[model samples]
Target: MNAIELLCKARKAKKEARSEIPLHHALEVRMQERGWKIVYYGDEAGNRKLASVGLSDFSKDIKSFAFRSNTSKVIAIDSRMPAKNRRHALAHEIGHIDLKHDLAHLTSGDEKDAERFARLICTDGTIFKRIAIYLFCILCLGFGIYGSVCIAATDDPNIQQIDVSASPAVNADEVVHFTASGEKYHRPYCSAIKGRSSFATSIEDAEKNGLEPCQMCHPDIN
Candidate 1:
């Protein structure tokens, strides 16, 4: 089925799931029900600074991201966005999660549908709101196409990949490292896992399991 059709079905499903609560609250409840965690970045002063420093490589235009693994799911929202826009962004990411869209590679059409789905979920579903959502999506699509072209023009071959996964279940109490089909365990933010299949584990567990430290991230030493 096409994106719109998928979105319509998702909307119907959401309505049936919790028709009484406000959309944002309903979405949050839905996420919790599915065992997904919601994290807001840039909430504190230190966090805002850290977010800006860490995400410098990403376009500031990007608002939120969703990450899913075999055992865990997380949706990180940008705390800097206006309240309404943040809600829309959260809903948009939820659309991605619910529709089973691949976060690593989303086409322009998928992005449009996701944005429209978000708007529909957030607003009162009036015709005027729908038209506005369409226009906004078109604008976003144009920006996305332009950005893709820019990235293609300056493609770099040596960029390190970071692996972010939610598998083997993480213990909130433990400091850990990650490895995906590799001999070495890496820090959660290490570039070595960029495109690799990996899961997080406690550092002690990693060593006990015979996983070595990543030379770059030095999870073993740190």
Candidate 2:
């Protein structure tokens, strides 16, 4: 199987997020729906940090990574990572676990698949296309037979119901002011809060920076 094939399989499994939803919640919901648990704790067999990897040894280059088993473990994303990166890392690791190639002990090819999976789930088509194209080139030139093998074995029957909301298109320097309509509050998830004065384009951005969603608005939930 090639990257396209892997992606086609993933798509067939209904794994794509909604076209425009915020990447963070879209990904988290998808992960749970697909049976990959998410947690903030650090004791899982895999951990997140400067980089994400599969512990199943799917790729030799990785010092560590997550693997697929009936073990019922959390994705173990690094709680301390920047919010944007933490979202991608967790999704990438979930790709590895979902692909189930770790049992074969193949590395690079699986890593590529995982990356591709991450791209598909966590990004827009423009970005996903770039990563997929790169993987196709590497698949043909780099791993040869092993690459083909890894691709062939990648399949799962899970899909995500993503919201498909566009990431806010705003200049970073734009002064985004909020009005506290009755002491507005936004709660995105188990952590973080938001207020009328929050200047972020999105609640997730605020939470990533260690701020919570407005308790009244609950931007994270929407």
Candidate 3:
């Protein structure tokens, strides 16, 4: 289906009451299924910023804007807000895309529908716990937690990837080093090292890194 059709499907599926899945989880499932990446940023500024000066209050509320010329995408989020509320806002913005709000002028009910969509997707029992963690990371970033959130395979079911990798360790000497290869994964959250064989962490002393969010994980994107 096209973007508009898929969005309509999501909207229809949303009408039914489901489990208490967070907005982030529901958007992730929907967006990922369509191969769109989600990126979370605290405030859009400087070179990292993607918003346009022409955006009005309506566009801001919509949460996403596209550059018509190049088809570049921007998903604006106020990450400084509360985590839960921020997640809701991001989800609402995503709902605009899911409901194809951009194809035409947004009606008054469009905003309300997007908000309802956010709440509906994030209900309960619909998204699994593991997926919930991913949702939490998205919300945390939206809450201004400047860290890179990534998913890794796990050996223990009880230990989620976020719990293990959210904070990477620094040496006792107060030095955080990353090899060239590992530098690619250097997120605002963790400092990773790439070796010929494996990846290791110290997990002793770590600092909250700046958020260099991913497009696939952040649901606030267009």
Candidate 4:
């Protein structure tokens, strides 16, 4: 499948799941509901990383993997990664599962489509909006095809980040903030958090605790 087809499949699966929760939580809940088990590396045998899951060389880079057998499907994630990254990895694996991508039989083209699909779903904004941006980029060739991919994948930080002055506070210069219920981290003055309950925290602390970047008031994605 191509990027558009993959994205359409993802949207269909998301609609059918219908958990009324965050995308990550909903995906996990749907997997469990379907009898698929999600486990961490330490939960199973061996103290190794992705190696224990049959991805030895990818141990350092891959965040998760999915395995399927005649009777069951299992997704395993690297517990050592930050919470936000772990969530994205899990969602990506879930994308493979939901889209029924056969790992054993996947072609190079299929693999690329799968990765692009996962990135789209894991992105902070709505799928429709992102797709619109991707299509617009394709039309405006001056931006380049790679630029289009970056937009769809949420890897273009320059486009995502907005400059907003920090709200007045003693620690405003040193701390970033995020809503208790949001995955996006933000600068103190971000209008996105204007009326919401938010907490001020250092970037290091926010990252260590696993908050993700805000699409509108982009903090670091990493």
Candidate 5:
């Protein structure tokens, strides 16, 4: 079909639909209504299945193709492509069906017509397409903000880093150290604690516990 004919056909079909659906899904339903099976394959396993039933030597270069199965016509598309390309390819294959091209013979004479059909159907301005475009923009914005946050975390010199291996802050004058069995408290590193396994407490706590300063370490000097 020419561009105008294709557009009219698509618009007529859209007006007949009970409700709106995604363009790709609507295309699948369009083909399905004619008893055609649509298969979207991505991985090697899916490719293998399509190869067995449809094109055995699938050119990785092409995105989609159509074939006549024993029971019904089948359309196969490469799912690895981005959603937009995948839809375009599927629509292109559907274009072949709608245009009544010889699927088995496969000729290039009508390639342009099929391409036009795909473009018209995909770009024909629908509420679903508008919503999809808006959602895609939102997703891109979210990723941009997340990526900016990640970059700032890695590149900003102002971000503080904690030295987990360093010792905690301590006020020497406010704290005193004593051994588990000792009767007196002394400053850390005092001679009295040089060979002792000591613990620490506040100076007031030590004094309240009836502990005195060690004379040998001159603990009271601090």
Candidate 6:
């Protein structure tokens, strides 16, 4: 999916911090939410040597930037920026993080997404938009396909030859499979049902069909 789609569907960054809220408090809350840290160019008013830290260019004027340091994400906002610009910068960096853009390889598309996200937060936002964002998230996460691991069929006594191609648009790795005659559905590679005459369906569907999960596989399709 695209960046915007991911933002709308997946759990990215929290964008509901109101404009009226204190930007510093918002920043602190946001940073804490993601286990992130914020810092200035200088510590105790001294320049932090950030040549290899993030995407900042000391030579050019920068509003704000985000980068990974060790095991944490850090957002660096220029101390010189005014209140308005600082808020934008905070949203911008938070945008980069929510988009999951690669700091090592910044791209035009990434910048555009960050800009869009920042503009969205910096301005007076609507509750409907925020609700819409998570509404899509619920639909996607609740019903979308999630197949990250491959399942292989094995020779088993209870089952015969397997044919995943019999089903359309179903990957053998992704969905739970079970025979209509059986009382239980199973992971595709489940020994009890592998190499058997079976129909593929999601775990949710299997349960809806009143099929219990197989004891051998302990199906966890998500």
Provide the lDDT at 106 for model 6: 81
Report the C-alpha lDDT of model 3 over 76-107, residue by residue, as the tens digit.
45555677766666667667766667534667
lDDT tens per residue, model 4, 48-133: 53354454443445667787777656777877778778777887777776667785676676665566556666665454444534
| Clashes per candidate (backbone, < 3 Å) | 6, 37, 19, 0, 0, 2
- Clashing residue pairs in candidate 1, if any? 161-191, 161-194, 162-193, 162-194, 163-193, 180-198
Score residue 181 of candidate 6 by CA lDDT: 39
Output the number of the lDDT-best candidate: 5
Give candidate 3's error at residue 17 in angstroms.
16
TM-score of 5: 0.49
Alpha carbon lDDT of each predicted model:
0.57, 0.46, 0.41, 0.57, 0.59, 0.56
Error of 3 at 29 (Å): 6.6
Q: What shift in Å separates residue 115 of candidate 2 from its native position after superposition?
A: 2.6
Q: Per-residue lDDT tens digits of candidate 5, residues 44-122?
A: 8877777667564664667788887567578888888899999888878877777778887767756766775566566
lDDT of 6 by residue, 100-168 (tens): 789768899788767766665554334334433333333334454432212224354543332223223
Q: Is 3 or 5 the stronger prediction by TM-score?
A: 5
lDDT tens readout by residue for model 2, 49-144: 222433433333432345456755446555556787777777677677667666348688787777777666665544553444445445545533
Candidate 3 or 4, higher TM-score? 4
Q: What is the lDDT of candidate 5?
A: 0.59
Ranking according to TM-score, highest score first: 4, 5, 1, 6, 2, 3
Off by over 4 Å in 3: 1-47, 51-70, 126-222
Better-scoring candidate (TM-score), 4 or 6: 4
- Winner on TM-score between 4 and 5 is 4
The candidate, 2 or 4, that scores higher on lDDT is 4
Per-residue lDDT, model 6, residue 62, is 66
Candidate 2 error regions (>4 Å): 10-15, 42-71, 103-108, 141-222
